[model samples]
Target: MARFIVRAIFAALGLWLASRVVPGVRVDDTGSLILAAVLLGLVNAVVRPVVFLLTFPVTLLTLGLFLLVVNAAMIGLVALLLSGFHVDGLLAGIVAAIITGFTSWVAGMVIGDAKRD
Candidate 1:
């Protein structure tokens, strides 16, 4: 419960960072940004696994590079679904995805270990 909230906050921060760092990726307002972030997290959790599984062969063929495209698609999907969040093009989506992913990874590191069973 608390862990999920924390992860969502981190994901929001990552999206905020992406908006700042990636040109053509824009959030109309702070509230919209946060909403987009939450939606992005939900989309990733719900849809990403299926997409990943279906693309496993392409992922392998590309030597893991296709993950970048998958990430970009996820970002693009968020932009399409969110009214106030906009990603201009594929390049913008890719850059925003990279920034968001890197920010999330760094945040995870800083947040340290998750609770173990």
Candidate 2:
């Protein structure tokens, strides 16, 4: 639970960074940004695998690059669900995915899989 919250905070940071750097990605405010982060985490957990499985053929054909589209789609889905979060186009979503992906990678390194009792 604590780990999840920490990761969500990091995800919010990435989203905030994306909003600032990407012209087409707009987050209305801090509240919306936080909501987007939590919503993104849920969407990625519940929806991404199914979408990935469904699009595996295209993803394979693209030599795995299409996963970027998949990731972007997940972000776009979050945007669709939230009024305050907006991704203007596929290009912006893709860029946001890159930023968020990097953030998650760093987060994973910081918060490893080791368990403590």
Candidate 3:
């Protein structure tokens, strides 16, 4: 429970960074940013695996590059669900997704290392 909350916070941090780095991604406020992060985490947990399975063929054919599209779609879906979260287009979504993923990965690594020390 606490772990999940921590991860959500890290995810929110990633989204905040994305909003700063990506020109076409906008998060209206802190509340909306956190909500968007939680919603994104839920969508990724529940929906992403299914979508990944369904698109396995294309993903394989693309040598895993199509996962970026999958990530972008997930971000776009979050934007649709939350009025305060906006993704201007697929390109912007892709860029935002990449940035968020990178930031979140770094956060995870830092947190994981902290636990070990």
Winning model by TM-score: 2
Score each candidate by Cα lDDT.
0.85, 0.95, 0.89
Candidate 1 to truth, TM: 0.90
**lDDT per residue as tens, model 1, 1-117:** 665666678778877887888888888998988888888888899999999999999999999989988988998899899899998898888888888888778767767668642
Error of 3 at 21 (Å): 1.4
Ordered from best to worst TM-score, the candidate numbers read 2, 3, 1
Give the TM-score of each candidate: 0.90, 0.95, 0.90
- Tens digits of per-residue lDDT, candidate 2, 40-88, equal 9999999999999999999999999999999999999999999999999
Ranking of all candidate structures by their lDDT, best first: 2, 3, 1
lDDT of 1 at 43: 88
Number of backbone-clashing residue pairs for each candidate, in the order shown: 0, 0, 0
Report the candidate with higher lDDT, 2 versus 3: 2
Clashes (candidate 3): 0
Write model 3 residue lDDT over 26-115, tens digit each, in one string: 999989999999999999999999999999999999999999999999999999999999999999999988888887787677667555
